[model samples]
Target: MHLSLGFSPCPNDTFIFDAMVNNKIDTKGLTFDTQLEDVETLNRWALEGKLPITKLSFAVYLKVKEQYDLLNSGSALGRGCGPLLIAKRDIPRDEIKDLTIAIPGENTTANLLFSIAFPEAKKKKIMVFSDIENAVLNGEADAGVIIHENRFTYQLKGLVKLMDMGEFWEETTGSPIPLGGIFIRKDVPADVRAKVDTLIHESLQHAYRHYPQLSDYVKSHAQEMDEQVMRQHIDLYVNDFSLDLGTEGKAAVTSLMEAAQKLRN
Candidate 1:
C-alpha cells in the first residue's frame, strides 16, 4: 500500500528519511508518496488531516492530537537542539518585552518556547523560517526566534542570541526538549502504523551506516549548506531518541503538551 508522508527539507529530516524514501532498506512492501514542505506548512496541513503521515512541531501536535498519533522514531528531541531567540543587536533583558519579534510560525515549538520564556513579549510576526535572520538583519524585526540551521549560522550573521530557549527548558523541566516528531493519521490501521514506525527506525539506522551517501540529498535542501553546519544539524538532532524516544523522550513530550495546553487556557 502507498502512503503520503510529509517532512521538512532540513538536513536532519533528509538524513533520517533518506534510506526509506530511496529504497536503501527494506520497506515491508510499503511505498511512500513523499511531500517536502516547511514544518509550519506541514503543521497546518495536519489541521486538515490531509496527509497520512507528516512531521510537526510538538506545539502543533498538541492541537491535533485527536487526529494523529506520534511515532516514536524520527523525532527531533535533545537538550541543546532547542530554538534560539536572536537579535541584530544585543537587547537588554528589560527591553526584550517591547521589541518586535518575528517567529517562524504560530504553531512552531520555537514560538511556544519563546512564549513560555517571554510571555510578556506581545508582538510577534510570522515569516518563513529561512527569512527570519534576514528580517532581523534588515531591521524588519527587532529580534527573531530561529530554529534548524539558523541556530548555527545566526552568530556568523552578526546576530546575538538573547536566549537559548532550549536551555531554559532544560533548566526548568530538567528533561530534553521535544521539538518535533513524525505523526501518522489515527485512521490508518494499527498494524500499518507499526510498520511505518519500524520503517522509520530502520531507515534511520541505514542512514547512519551510509551517512556519506546521504550528504548530497541533505545539502540540496538545507537552508544553509555549510558542510559543518549540516553535519552539526544531523549530529545534534538524530540521536538515540531519533531511533526511539524511550522513557525520557516520552516524558519530555508529555511535559511539553501540558505546557502547551496551559498556554491555550
Candidate 2:
C-alpha cells in the first residue's frame, strides 16, 4: 500500500521526508505527499485523521492527541532557531512598544516563543508568515515577526532582523526547542509504521553523509534560499539533534506544552 506522507517546503525536511529524490528517502511501503504547508495546516490534517502521515506541532498534537499517534517528534525548527523579529533599522528594541507587530500562525512555535518573551506586549497581532514583509514594507505593521522562508527573503525588502529568536531560545533554555514531528494515524499498522520509522531514520543517516550537498537540497526544495539561511535553519533544527530527537527535544516539548497548558488551568 502507498503511504501518503506530508511535509512543509522549508529547508529542514530535505533531510527527513523526500522519497524519489534519493533512494535514501524512505517510505516504508508508503508514499509521500510532500505537501508544503505551515505547521497550522499540517496540524489541521492531523486532527481530522486525514493525515495518515503528517508533520505537526506537539502543541497541536496535544490538542488532537485523541486522534493520532506519534511516529517521531522533531521538526526542522530547532529550539535555538527561534523566529526573527523584524523592524526598520531605525527602530530600537526599547522603542518597539506601541508598534504593530506582525505574527504568522496563531499556533506556530515562534509566536508561542514571542508570547513567552513579551507576555506584556499588549499591542501585537498576527499576519500570515507569508505576509510579514509586505506588511512591514507597506507600514501596516511597525515590525513583523517573520518565520520560515521570510527569514531568508525579508532582508531583500529592507526589513531589518531585530532579533534572532532561535539564538535567544538556545541562550535561555540550553536545549533545542521541539518544533514539529512526523506522525502516523492512530490506527496505522504498528508494524508498518515501525518500518516507516526505520526507513526515515536510516535515510536521515544517509542524508547526513552528504552534508555538503544539503545546501543544494535546500535551494532546490526551499526556492533558492541562501546557503547561510539554509545552514541556520539546519543548525537550529537539525544536526545531531536531528538524528536522535534527543532527550533535550522531548524535554523542550514537554516544557512548552506544560507552559501552554497553564493558560487553560
**Pairing residues by index, what is the TM-score of model 2?**
0.83
Model 1, 1-265: lDDT tens per residue? Answer: 9999999999899999988998878899899999999999999999999899999999998779999999999999988989989997777888888989999999999999999888899999999998999999998999999998888888888999998999999999999999999999999999999999999999899888876555567778874477888888898888999999999999999999999888889
Taking all chains together, each candidate's TM-score versus the true structure is 0.97, 0.83
Tens digits of per-residue lDDT, candidate 2, 1-265, equal 6667777777777655543334555454555555667777786677677767777766575676777766653355364456888986767666666677888766667777776666656576676678888888888888878876676677788778887866776777776666677777877788877776677777676766777567354578776566777766665566655565666666877777776676536
What is the alpha-carbon lDDT for the whole of candidate 1?
Answer: 0.91
Stretches > 4 Å off in candidate 1: none
Top-TM-score candidate index: 1
- Considering summed lDDT, which 10 consecutive residues are worst modelled in model 2? 19-28
Which segments of candidate 2 are over 4 A away from where they belong? Answer: 19-22, 25-28, 77-79, 89-98, 122-125, 153-156, 214-219, 226-232
